[model samples]
Target: MSGAVWSYSENESVSNEVASAAADVAKGASAEPVVLEIGAVRAGVRAPGAKLLLKGPATSDVPPEVAAEAIAKASKQLQPAAILIGATRYGREIASRLAVKLTVGCLSEVSKLSADGNALAGERNAFAGKVVAKVSCALPAIATVKVGYYAAVESAGTAVTESDVGQVNPLVKVVSREKKAAGAVDLRSAKVIVSAGRGVKKKEDLPMLEELAREMHGALGCSRPLSSDLGWLPEEHHIGLTGVTVKPDLYLALGISGQLQHTAGMKDSKVVAAVNTDKDAPIFQASDYGIVGDLYQIVPAIRKALASRR
Candidate 1:
């Protein structure tokens, strides 16, 4: 309860975000915020706190298992009150492993976090994101901080302390790596997003939505069904609780039903609009504007309206 708050992430950007969250928690606890960097010390160098560089053979291109081992070893030595990890795929694995190694509780995908005396309280979505639950764990806890909940922070020049953790042989060896197919746009950074859903009907109908997105100078996104079930779009385009989280300025859900799983990802959007044939669809509950009509019919009308103004 009296030690520093620790944070780590494989991605530099996410690491920075976790650092910010750590700093916030540490402030309330009156403890230092420490950043742990494996493989390389790049993220810790820019983080706004003390940096612990765990250097070793296990540090090079550190796999999740190796990174978790290194972190667990470090945690045993430092005995931090709490550890904040970015909730990326690998980060989740690392958090779980660390929790087991340390024999502490772990919270996954927490959007809001704070330090409360000897415990840490976190808020996370539950029941497919239809409900928000407040959860708490005693000190020496591990929690995966949800992405986009906190922005990265930078501090004036801070020194990093390097410690050699030595070599670690991983159980899982990566023989090859292949990049996922890249999308035409990065939906996370887009100001406007036109998302499709199961209502899209077919892959051939995607062009219509794509044209709408292009006309609005936005990117095309989709629900999990479109990407995971139908394969009409790549997984990169999917936005949901299990997929990418986005906070666009304008989120236009076209033919999307607005399931809790899908809305959890884009609920942070500044403005939301939905065009669906079902007037009673769940998507309307989450949207700021609703058009109860067929997207096939509504899309052309919107295009015509925009054309006339031009």
Candidate 2:
């Protein structure tokens, strides 16, 4: 319980955020916070405390299975009180495997984290973001911190230590890697988001929403249906529990039905405005401002109103 806290993420930026969260936990518990980096440590990484670089054959572009093995080995020696992994696709796998190896509980997708006595406590969305559950586990537990929840800390002067974790033969092998198609917008950093949903009718109607987004100085986004089901937009434009999670200053849900899966991604938005024809739509319940009307009628009026203001 008195040991240092460890944080790791496959993504450099996300690792920095985990480091910030770990620092906060360490402060409350009066313990050290250490950032664990696999392979070569990046020069840009800034941890609030110390950095531990794990080097080995298994650490080189290591798959989750191999990386988890190396981390478990290091953790056994370090005896960290808690390990925080970024809640990314691969991160979840690492956390699960580590928890099994350590025989400790794993908390997934935790947004708010804190030190609870000698144990770790966190709050995560449950029931599709409809409820926030407070979870706690014994010391030596593992938890995946939700991406974008904690800001990356700046600690350019932190100490660094390197250790060779040794080679691991992975069960799966990566044959090749290819970059995904880049989108014009990065939804994660967008301050304002105008998201379309199933009600958009057809692919041809997207340009209207795109124009609205441009007028509002925001990026175009869509619910999973518009992206995965209808293929109206690229997968990167999708926002939901299974897709990208976002926390923008303003989220405008146009013709969205507000399924729990969709709301799960944007519930953390500072302000939410929704337009729907159904008065009892679920999106209205989650919105700070709601207009019950057809988007076909409302959108044009909104654009005209903004034009007059200009």
Best by TM-score: 2
Clashing pairs in 1: none
For model 1, residues 1-310, the per-residue Cα lDDT tens digits are 5788889898877888999889888885778899888867673448766888888754446778999988888788778899999999999999999999899999888866888878888899888777889999988899999988788887766778877777778899989977788655689878899999877778998998888889888999999999998888888899998889999999999999988889989998999999999999999999999999998899899888978888
CA error at residue 180 for candidate 2, angstroms: 2.1
lDDT of 2 by residue, 148-216 (tens): 999987768777798778888888999998766765478898998999998788899889999999899
The local lDDT score (0 to 100) that residue 98 gets in candidate 2 is: 96
Q: What is the model-wide C-alpha lDDT for candidate 1?
A: 0.87
| TM-score for each of the candidates | 0.93, 0.95
**What C-alpha lDDT values do all the predictions have?**
0.87, 0.88
By lDDT, who's the top model here? Answer: 2
Error of 1 at 306 (Å): 3.3
- In angstroms, the error of model 1 at 158 is 2.8
Residue 19, model 1: Cα distance from true site in angstroms:
0.8
